[model samples]
Target: NIINARLRGKPGLFRVALNGERIAAIVPQTDVVAPAKGNDLDAGQNLVVAPFVEPHIHLDATLTAGEPKWNMSGTLFEGIERWSERKEITTHDDIKTRAKKTIGMLVDHGIQHVRTHVDVTDPKLTALKAMVEVRDEVRELIDLQIVAFPQEGIESYANGRALMTEAVAIGADVVGGIPHFENTRDQGVSSVKFLMDLAERTGCLVDVHCDETDDPQSRFLEVLAEEARVRGMGARVTASHTVAMGSYDNAY
Candidate 1:
């Protein structure tokens, strides 16, 4: 238990009890001091909060500002273009080294959990393999969730389906797709269905990069949502970077 804890944005001293790592109870402070116990902590009016959670991050591409070439345009496609070149020259050790350093910074800032999307578009699966190793290596320091993300496209890229299958067979905790990046709208819908079906077959979570483009016409989010709702798997699915939602018309 932590006594004399100051509640954030609240006027009061409180006592926080724990059931293992989770908070079991919290009550207003009564006594000036808590009884001496080896396990108990005295917060001394300091604010306490649970460690931060990083829901979306790309550990594979972290700490690479201008390695191969600069993304002078600062657009998503440009970033992907730079990363494609970077991935070509990046070795396994280089990926692991960069990912570990990035995780170290997250840990120092009180982030205890992280979900990193490792690109699996490459037929070689260089990033996914390297991140899988780093996930196990940093398990003691933080909880790492590795998603097999197809950065380029599922149907647009060559041998995309096979690479995704191999990624999950290896150690990917989640299945990912970039629907907006597909060349055609039909292919985007098919990619969403394919990724959802793959997750079900492999018993993995889904975290798709859906509707990342600024085009309001990109309505793949509906397909993804309907797929999850129809299958009763909404809790196991996530749609990240839905930037098009903001540009969408109010009437629709």
Candidate 2:
């Protein structure tokens, strides 16, 4: 038997055996092997689980609240607009410092995996570069995945595709979009298609900020699902912030 070690909860009621980094078996506490073998660790009856994962976070925009002012409107649009002003003064060092500190907090909370969306709409790619540096620097402590996100819009923003391409070339791990922020419904649908095509071309995963509004007519998620199904990229695609789903009718 190639058993690596055993993990137990306080008093050893539940036990799990590992092979290398993978779980080999989960046995009862009564069946646990003696710890004298030097591989058994009792976790003191607390909840013993795999490290936590944070799926969606904005590393570039985090810890920048109330820089020039506050988001009095309390809407996503207002937040984005306010962030634009703050972003004007942002530097690579600023992004790296904030991101590293936030990652430290996440690690303290037992989060070993995190996927962060870094804004790529900026022509300078300041945040993307800094995040890539942070990603490599913290690789030993966390699995950090970066998304090349066009927070403004895919088509609505100037040179958005070019910026996104530069972002991935510099080490962004995934493709991202903000379809709900497009100028119109037609533009929103087109943006999703563009992102799906981009993902296929680059062989990157997709995560979109879809319909993060309370409007019942926000249907970008439906388009996103259909595109994912048509392209056979089902599980690899994710639609985040679909708050509008709450307003959907039961029949829908």
* TM-score of every candidate relative to the true structure: 0.88, 0.86
Which candidate gets the maximum lDDT versus the true structure? 1
lDDT of each: 0.92, 0.86
Q: What is the overall TM-score of model 1 with all chains considered together? A: 0.88
Candidate 2 off by > 4 Å: 1-18, 24-46
Candidate 1: segments with Cα more than 4 A from true spot:
1-4, 10-19, 24-45
Extract clashing residue pairs from model 1: none
The 10 consecutive residues of candidate 1 with the worst lDDT sum are 28-37
lDDT of 1 by residue, 73-183 (tens): 999899999999888888889999999999999998999999999999887898898998898899899999999999999999999999899999999999999999999
lDDT of 2 by residue, 130-227 (tens): 99999999999999999999988888999987888788889888999888888888989888988898888889999998889888889999999999
